[model samples]
Target: MNYDVFNGDADGIIALLQWRFADPLETQLVTGVKRDIKLVEQVEVQAGDELAIFDVSMEKNMSALEQALAQGAHVFYADHHRSGTIPSHGNLDAHIDLDANTCTALIVDKLLKGRFHTWAITAAYGDNLIAKADELADKAGLDAGQKAQLKELGTLINYNGYGSKVDDLHFHPADLYQALKQYVSPFDAIADNASPYYQLQSAYQQDMNAAQAVPAVHESSKLKLFVLPNNAASRRISGVYGNWLANQNPDSAHAVLTENADGTYTVSLRAPLSNKQGAVAVCGQFSMGGGREAAAGINALSKDDLAAFIDAVETYYA
Candidate 1:
């Protein structure tokens, strides 16, 4: 069996989309919530299996990756996250770029020589690489209206991936991906009124409205922090709300905390867009926290750690 393991977010799904468009394959997909990074272990590997992995961090999925290589699986891995030392094996094909401005789909775009460049651009937008996506859109000569459409589409798809579990989402990432795979171009999906884009567009507006009503629990020159009440809506809006906050105040670091049932918090941290640095550093001091420099998150932060998390963000950006 061929297994395709990827993050449930736009960058991961679109990364795989570009590959399948370039090299059509019958593969079993393994994906989960945006924070579910240990995807490589989900597949039972056997000799001669083809494994395609994307967007998930290599360091987090190292053991399963090594097992797949040892099991004689031919593995193709691509990502933009920090990867520990890559394994040395002829059966493994690894494509990793740690650049803050780039994402997995753009890496796949390079591999395919831009055969599916527009889709790659959409993924970049979805990953919140706004400036980078704009540059690519300009280079592609996409008109202003077209660029806006792509950004909105990307944001909606990304918004759908924020929930703590699959059930909290508007559409499970796997389902959303399957729903989108029919379109060779994102614009085609937009033209189809029944597409996920339309569904997500409406839903996103509702959740974003609720999130906007939430004022910052902690605000300072270096950082602003918002703690949202626990609910499916809060879970859905947490990360995207953080992204919105970061965009609104490009000079200030931002954190969006969603209260978990256990009284802990799920944290999404974004460094200032103007100076994309230290997010991972700040989050890394906590357990279940790790991500790229521009964006990072803590899957579950105890309530007691709230004060420390805030101070860490302020100190790092100070």
Candidate 2:
């Protein structure tokens, strides 16, 4: 048996597509929304089975993966998440890189030497690594309109992965991947599958509109903070809101915090365009892991820590 485990997002889907396209094989896919990082435990791999894991970090699910490897299964993992010490195992082939500029799609592209460069670019755009995506797009000879279409598709696909639960999404990331597989590129998919693409675009617009309507909680000269209620739409809107706020106020840091079902909060932190660093440190105080100097995310923070977290953010900048 061969199991394909990936994060249910554009980068993961495109990475899996490249791997499968490179070596056409029959494999059971394991995936979930962006928040569902423990997807490897869902599968039951027997001895002699092979596993391909992408996007999801090996460190976070090291125990389950170690057990699978111990049972004689060979695992190939690629990811960009912050990983702790990687264990040495004969059957494990890990390609873990935590560089903010690198994603699973780009990793696969590097491995394959741009065999599927366009798809890698789309995944990069979807992951909000715009400068990197544009560089690849320029190298691939994509014109302005083509780049825009690919970016829209990438953003839509990325947005679909934002919700806290499956029901909150416009389409499940796996289903979106299945749909995408039919077309060779994002523009092809948008042209061939007009209905689904339009539907997703419309839903994205609605979510963005709702996000824009939310009043800012605090608007200082240097920072703007917004708190959203615990709702499906809020989960989907939080990231978009943070990005929008950062763009609207280029000189100020933005924090968009969404309340979760358990009375905790999921936080998206973005530094000003002028200073894109320390968000990971801010989230670290609340026990979250993310990348780069510009942006980071915390999965959940207890209600008790909310006040302290805000104060820390204030002091960090002060």
Candidate 3:
């Protein structure tokens, strides 16, 4: 058996696609939302099985992975996350590069040496490394219009991974992967498979427009909190909405919280461009971890901690 675990986002899916294209193999997939880093532990591996892991941090799931390795499974890991320490094992092969600008899609691109450069460019755009994507797009001889389409597709795919659950996504990552499997490149997908691509893009724009209509619940000189209803639509739009708010209000740190089915809150944090420093620090106090200096997310937070979280942000800004 071959098992492939990846993050449920454009970069992860593209990475998986590149691997599959390079070496056509039947593999079971394990994935979740963008922030779900512990996907490797969700599967049970048996002896002689092969596991290919991508886009998830080894540091976060090292123990479970080590257990699988010890059980005699051969593991191949590729990620750009912060890897703490790799276990010394003969059966394990890890390709981890932690450069902030590097994503799993680029890793696969390097490994495959541009076998699927177009897909790699889409993943880079999804990761918000637009300059890198643009460079690759130029090398691939894509025009501005084509590059914009790829970037939008990448952004839409990335946005689809924002919500707390599968219900909130425009399309489940697995289903999206199936849709991509039929097309050779993202450009080809847009050109040939117009229905799925345009359908998702249309839905994404609708969600963004809806999110723009919601008024901010609280705003001060330095911080703003945008509270969204616990609807599937709101959840789908949360991250992109938060990003829009951050860019629109560059002086105010933005936190977008959507009520979840369990009554807890799913939070998306965006540090204002002016500061770009407090979100991780504040969310860290609440035990949520993320990076990118300008953006991050917390999977869940109790309603009880809302006050403290607000206070922390206020204090940080003060």
Candidate 4:
């Protein structure tokens, strides 16, 4: 059996899409909500089975990966997230780049020699590497109109991946991958009005409208915080809303907190786009939290710690 396990975000989905589009395969797909990184353990691979993994952190899935390799499954892994020491095994091929400006899709693009270059650019945009994506788009000779299209498509696909669970998403990541795989190029999907691009765009607009109406619960020169009500919509929109906030106020750090049912908060933190640093360190101070330097998150933060989190962010950015 062949299994493709990937993170259910724009980068993961599109990275796999580029690969499968290059080499069509019969495989079992394993994915989950954006936060579910332990996908490799879910696949029951036997000797001789093939495994392809993308976009998820190797540190989080190391045990499962070791298990798959020990079970004689040949594995190909690619990602840009934090990876502890990588294992050296005859049956495993791991491609990892921790560069702040790179993502898994871009790694795949490099491997494919840009056969699906446009999709890689879209993934970059979705991952919130705005300046990086713009540079690639310009180098590719894409006009302003074309670049805008790719940016919007990338943003929408990314927006679909933020939910706490699949139930809150517009389309399961697997289904989104399948839908997008039908088009050889992302522009093809945009050209067709009947594509997931349009559906996601509409849904994203509705959620953004609701999110924007809620004013900041706290604001200061160094940090601004918004607390959203507990609901599926809040869970679905908080991450993207954080991205939006970071872009809107590039000089100040921002936090988007969605009230969880357990009275905790699912937190999304973004360092000022002007200085994309310290967010990971700030979030790392909390349990169930850690991420890249530019953006990080806390899966569930105690209500009591909310003030402390804000203070930490402010102090770091100050």
Candidate 5:
């Protein structure tokens, strides 16, 4: 069997889309919510299987990766998140870069020699590499209007991935991927008024309106924190909301915590855009927290640890 395992986010989906567009494949897709990074284990790998994985942290999925390799599966893995250690196995092909300015789609773009460069730029924008994406956009000769469209398109795709579960999302990642696979160029998707772009834009605006109404739970020069009420909308907007907050105040670290049904919180943290180096470290101090340096998250933070998490972010930025 051939499995395309990817994070449900824009980076993962676009990375895989570029690869598959260049090399058409009839494969089963394995993906989940944006935070479900341990996806490699979800698959029951068989000998001779081929798995193309993207976006999720290799460190979190290392054991499952090893299991797949041991079972004689050929695994192609690519990501930008922290990868503890890479294995040297003939059956495994890994491409990982830890640069905060680059994402998995950008790496795959390099491999594809920019066959789908526009899509890669969109992924970068979606990942919140705004300055880098803008630079690339200028280099690509995209006019101001075009750049704005791509940014909005990328942001909407990314926002669609933030839900706590597939049910919370407007469209399943796999479904979203297939919807987008029809167009090799992101512009084509945007031009099609009857596309996911339009759908997501409408949904995103509504969610953002709700989010903006919630006042900050804590704010300081070092860090600004907001705790959203538990709901589908809050879960669907947490990560992207963190990105929005970080962009709004580039010098202050931002955290968006969404209350869970069980009173725990799902935390999304973004290091100051001016210094995108400590988000992963700050989040790593908590259980179920991990990501790239610019953006990281804790899947479930106890209510009690909320204060500590805030202190950690403040200290890191201070």
Candidate 6:
């Protein structure tokens, strides 16, 4: 059996899409909400099975990866997250890059020699490597109109992954992947009015309208904090909203907190775009928190620690 395990975000989805597009395969897809990075543990592999993992931290899935290797499964892994230590296993082929500007889709793009270059650029945009994506788009000679199309498509695909659960998402990641696979180029999807691109555009605007209407809960030169009510719209918009906030105030760190059922908060933190450093470090201070330097998140933060988290952000950026 062949299994393709990846995160549900645009980067993960596009990375796998590039691989499957270049080398078509019938495989079982294992994915979940964007935050569910431990997808490798969910698969039951046997000797001789093939596993391809993408955009998920190997550190979080280390034990499951070891189990799969021990069971004789051949695994191909690629990601840009904090991978604590890579295990040496003949059955594992790991391609990981921790560069601040690199993502798994870009890694695959390099390996495939840009066989699906446009799709790779979209993933880069989705991952918030905006300047890098723009550079690549310019190098490819894409016009302003084309670049904007890719950016919106990428952003919408990314926004679709922000929901707290698959139930909150407009389409399951697997379904969205399937829907998008029909297009050899992302522009084709945009050209099709009935495509997921248009659907997501409408949905995203509605959600953003609601999110933008809410004022910031706290603001300062060092950091800006916003607390959102616990609801599907809030959950769906939090991460993208953080991205928006960071871009709007490039010199200040931004945090978007969504109230959780248990009175905790789901936190998304973005370091100042002017200095994309210490976000992962700040988030790492809390349990259920880990991400790249530019963007990080805490899965569940106690309401009691909210003030402390704000203090930490302010201190770090101060």
Error of 6 at 223 (Å): 0.7
- Stretches off by above 4 angstroms in model 4 are none
The backbone clash count of each candidate, in order, is 0, 3, 0, 0, 0, 0
Residue 289 shift from truth in candidate 6, angstroms: 1.0
Give the winner by lDDT. Answer: 5
Cα error, candidate 6, residue 235 (Å): 0.7
In TM-score terms, candidate 2 sits at 0.91
Give me the displacement of residue 14 in model 6, in angstroms.
0.8
* RMSD (Å) per prediction: 0.8, 2.2, 2.7, 1.2, 0.7, 0.8
lDDT of each: 0.92, 0.80, 0.82, 0.91, 0.93, 0.92
lDDT for model 6, on a 0 to 1 scale?
0.92
lDDT string, candidate 1, 1-318, tens digits:
989998988899999999998898888989988899999989999999999999999999999999999999999999999899999999999999998999999999999999998899999888889999999999999999999999888888888888888999999888988999999999999999999999899899999999899998999999999999999989988888888888888999999999999989999999999998788889999999999999999999998999999989988988
> Per-residue lDDT for 189-256 in model 6, tens only?
99999899988999999999998988888999999898889899999888888888888989999999
Worst 10 residues of 3 by lDDT: 287-296
List candidate 5 segments past 4 Å from native. none
- Stretches of candidate 1 off by over 4 Å are none
TM-score (C-alpha, index-matched) for candidate 4:
0.97
Give candidate 3 misplaced runs (Cα > 4 Å). 193-195, 220-223, 245-253, 272-281, 288-294, 310-318
**Which residue pairs overlap in candidate 4's backbone?**
none
lDDT of 4: 0.91
- Candidate 2 lDDT by residue in tens digits, 59-96: 67888898998899999988887667887999989888
Off by over 4 Å in 2: 247-252, 272-276, 287-294
- The lDDT-based order of candidates, best leading, equals 5, 1, 6, 4, 3, 2
Give each model a TM-score.
0.99, 0.91, 0.87, 0.97, 0.99, 0.98
- Candidate 2: what lDDT? 0.80
